[model samples]
Target: MIWLLDLDNTLVGRDDAFALWAADAVARAGGSGDDLAAIVAADGGGFARKTDVARVIADRLGWEADLPAVVERFRAGILAHVRAYPGVPALLDGLRAEGDRVVVVTNGTSAQQRGKIARCALAPHVDAVVVSEEEGAAKPDPRLLEVALGRVGADGADRRDVWMVGDALHADVAAGRAAGVRTGWVSHGRDAGDGPAPDVVGRTVHDVVAAVRALAAPAGPAPARP
Candidate 1:
């Protein structure tokens, strides 16, 4: 089986890292208590584009730094806190042990996403990684998933054996369904929401790991070969 995993908020706690980064950025700007909250709010929970976030910070704090400098600071801040969620490393290792291929499919700028993967020590665990900026297509777009499949040497013949595991229903889950592959959604304690339900739903990454293992189990010794 092939596993296509989502990077941010799935394997790693991107929101937690972003909060730490916002605090650090606020301190660096010599802003007060209220400023931190304001900055974090303006960040849109890290969903805002980096350039736009930088501009907002500069305008709000009266900073003279250019966009590039602001972006550099943002990346540095996030990199400093990059960490995988509990059980992620072991999960990847276990999948590899079972001879299952794993690919990271993410939607973000190459620099930012790569930084997270490298800083979090995730590169060695997966077979390949496909970033939206590098691939010219993001999640919810079947093309990006196709690129990931190709990197893992999977063709349409293997689609039935592929699974996309992610936290976002609209993006990751939708993309997998659109690509005609199975999807496992990491609900993270939220409702699964309105849409075609995912083939599997788990409240945590650890749970998802268990589900995948069950799916890939040996099928009772292949029915004793008849």
Candidate 2:
């Protein structure tokens, strides 16, 4: 089986490095501890400068703008907080043990995403790392999935043979469905959804791993909302 996993909130909970940087930026910008957060919420640029979250922070602080320099600092915080969610490593290892090919389908730029992978030590276990920054598009985009499939050779296979696991319905689940792959949602350790549901759901990475190990393959149900 080939697994395309999400990073933030999926592998690691959404206690973002951007949020931490925003906290510090807020203080540096002469605002309250929460002041810079508005920019981060509005901007999604990690270290790649997608939305320029740090630039917004600098602007809010009325400081001279420096995209390159601020990106480095912001990434430092992000890498520092690059802690994986509980049981993530176990699941990845288990999948490898099962002779599965695991590829990280994440969004962000070359530097930002690579930093996380390096800090998290993900390269050794996974087969490949695909990020939107390099692909020129983000998830839920079949183009990105196609590129990933080309990398891992998942083409001509049914959705049942592949599993797309993540925490976000709009992003990961939507991407899975778009790519015509099975879906397993790690719903923030709840492992269960109240309204709609996934083919298989896990509250944590470990539960998903258990489901994967028990099931014959990745034939999953539809996705539900939070």
Candidate 3:
């Protein structure tokens, strides 16, 4: 079986990292508490584009640096705060032990996403990493999922054996459904609500891992004791 995972807020605490980074960046820029709040709001939980984020920070903080430099600073701070969620490393190891192929299919700029993946020590766990920007297609568009499957040498015929796991409903779950594969949504406390239902729903990465393990486990009862 192949597991296609989402990086931010799925395998790692990306929102936590973004909060820490944004607060520090705002303070360093001599911005007030309100400025930090505005920056965080503008970040849209890392959904907003980096260029837009940089522009907001620069304008709000009265920074003199160019957009590219501001983006670099933001990226550096975010990377510094990157850390995998608890049990993620072990989960990846367990999946590998079960002979499952893992791939990180994330939506973000190559530099930012790759930096977070490396900084969080996620690279060593997965067989391949696919960034949306690099592939020229983001999630919710089935083509990105197709690209991911191709990287793992999977095709439409193998969709049944593939699972797409992520936190976002519209992006991850929708993408999986569009690609005709099973989907697991990490609810993180919020209800999945009404839409295209997921094959499995879990509150955290560990829960999802357990679900996957069960799915991949051999069926039927044990044979007579020898």
Candidate with best lDDT: 3
State how far residue 178 of model 1 sits from its true place (Å): 1.0
Put down candidate 3 lDDT per residue, 147-195, tens digits, no spaces: 8888878765478789999999889999999999999989898887775
Look at candidate 2 and tell me the lDDT of residue 96. Answer: 88
Reference-based lDDT, each prediction: 0.85, 0.72, 0.87
Model 1, range 115-204, lDDT digits (tens) per residue?
899988999999999999998899899899999999988876477789998988888999999999999999888887696578888998
- TM-scores, in order shown? 0.85, 0.76, 0.88
Which of the two, 1 or 2, has more lDDT?
1
User: Predictions ranked by lDDT, top down?
Assistant: 3, 1, 2
Q: List clashing residue pairs in candidate 2.
A: 189-203, 191-202, 191-203, 199-221
- Give the clashing residue pairs of candidate 3, or none: none
Better of 2 and 3 by lDDT: 3
Q: Which candidate, 2 or 3, has the higher TM-score?
A: 3
Ranking by TM-score: 3, 1, 2
